[model samples]
Target: MTDTRVAVIGGGVIGLSIAYHLAEAGVETTLLERGALGSGASRATADVVRSYFAGNPVSSALAVRSLEAYRAFPVRPGTDLPLRQVGYLVLFSAPEQVAAFEADLPAQRRAGVDVRLIGVEEARERNPLLGDLPLLAAAWSPQAYVSDTAAIVTAYAEAARRSGATLLTGRPVSRIDSAAGRVFTEDGGELTAEAVICAAGAWSPALVRGAGVDLPMTAPIEQELLVTDPLPPGTPEIPCTLHAASGLLSRTRGDRLLVGMGYPGPDREAWRREVAERFAETYPGLAELDLHPAVTGLRDASPDRRAFIGHLPGPPAFLYATGFSGHGLCNAPAAGELVRDLYLDQDPGIDMTAFAVGRQRTG
Candidate 1:
């Protein structure tokens, strides 16, 4: 398929994965990044990998595919992923939360999530910092995992390189001539490709708009993690805890305990105060642990948290693979496979109609 060259805009995880998959599929692929690869939201991820969607079964299924891909990646030919199968627990703080969680249970089970609701005592037994915090219930995902996102990106990039893909960093695309299947950079460098995939993360709107399509999205400065120094001897590593109602989540990163929420910097005082109060009530020792911000960046939010994963309608034929919100890193592999399938005009195995760029949003 000499005529099927693909130029993937954005060398972040999604773009890189798409390039890797495309090149591996024997399509000539080139990936462009303004800076270093995986230096964007890919690395900014909270890194907790799980498949338990709140209500979206399709999204949950994609997540399950992605997590399975990561789990099996190391054994695959040219990859080394530093993945840790630490469990993930979503706690119910109130009765309403329990009800809300129950609504999600059916979808979660449908997505093949190995989970169950446990009592507060079981939660505390698993997490030492969990004092008698009056948690009503908790959903345990025993197969959930975490990883160094950069490492995974590196593995994808390495695999793509091995597959004969060209990776160009410090080269940003300025325009795309969708009609001519061409990509242009600020330096006036141009490359013609059969397919152009927009995976620019937060910077995608402008690029997609320039390509004669408007992909409605938001790039919010998300405070994803509030890390602390190494935990003391008493405080041991615990599963990733997401207090869904409060939006406060915690997991161990090496020796540090990471507390995270979506609060902005202007509300740092309020955020820390609330997190501290919650820690005091639940996790005792980490209550006073000073938070150190790490890998916080803009989250590419969409109408729903789910990603848009289909081809943008065009004579130029562009593929939209951005808008994953906070799930970009974990689902990169599945997204890559989908991009490849779409490019080759093959069935994606998963139903992608829900991810289609709607008629109202597509200009």
Candidate 2:
């Protein structure tokens, strides 16, 4: 019989982080994953970490804490958090776009996001790749950086194991008896715990449903394309650039530029073309570069675009840490810490009402 104090169902970065925090705090924790670690959203992350959320101060604060954790991540053999401090540049092409971002600048700044508004000329000076693309303004997050998602997940898993947490891979959890604090696996295996955390990302809603809890979550497919430069030396390294006019992104990793967007459409061909055309229009300097196949992943999105943390109503100790939208990578560290404090029944030092289960969605 396998029993632990807390059972975390998911092996993504968020789950691993939660297990690590809980176990490190002397909570008997066990994390079960259906496949290898980071096989889900973590594997398909855009690999960018930034603390600039337009209108969400809570998310920005979480991101700041997460970034701090990444900088202070324990370094050991096979567990290195490689960070590329290329920063992030958000371009605004329209007046309304600029105004909306400007309105949120104060909130983001108060949340410890080192962001500021810059004029088009200054923005172009920072990134010459903008070419002749018109820009109204830009949000510059100089401290934002990119890191490898798989590396962070593996590092946290190791840290959790070192802290005496049981990490199980290929253990597909079929269902959970939340009221009973028991989890059943597809291979006819069963385990019990005092609490169960449904951090399964896009696969969480179904699992929570079996426990009679209908999470307001949706699984949306998001994709990023890898564009390779034939000559690496000639490639101009650019910040993680996002065009606010359109949800298009481009950032550099070695010789390749990662371009991606979330296009809610039935035709994937149209999506790819849009990504290509947008990148070309935004960065005309590298328009002719080689475009590789698009990489895809699922996001567990909530209505407010913020995550739903904290435990559910009544009994069985069912805690939820899913619905991160697209901020999972940047917010996992703080999310883990928050979940840990919640499970321990201690103050997490952050505003719990912001991420409370039944709180009003202001955004």
lDDT winner among the candidates? 2
| Winning candidate number (TM-score) | 2
**lDDT tens digits, residues 1-363, model 2?**
438889999999899999999998999999999999988778777788888877777889999999988888854223557888988888988998888887888888888999988999888877777878777789888877888887788788888999999999999999998888899999999998888998999888889876677767765655445555553466678898888878887787766877777644588777777777877887776778767764666667877778888775435588989888888999999999999988888889988778865565453
Where model 1 places Cα greater than 4 Å from the true spot, the runs are 1-4, 265-274, 313-315, 359-363
Candidate 2 — which pairs collide? Answer: none
What does candidate 1's lDDT look like per residue over 1-363, in tens digits?
223477899988899889888888888888888789987787677777777766666677888888888888877536766777778888888998788777878878887777778888887777767766668888887867878777878888888989889999988888877778888888888878777888988888888876777777765556456777678765578898887767778888878887776666577778777776765666765666767667666668777777877785445578978888877876788899998999888999887877876733552
Candidate 2 — which residues are off by over 4 angstroms? 75-80, 313-315, 358-363
TM-score of 2: 0.93
Give the Cα lDDT of each candidate.
0.78, 0.82
TM-score of 1: 0.92
Q: Estimate each model's TM-score.
A: 0.92, 0.93
Q: Which ten contiguous residues of candidate 2 have the minimum total lDDT?
A: 223-232
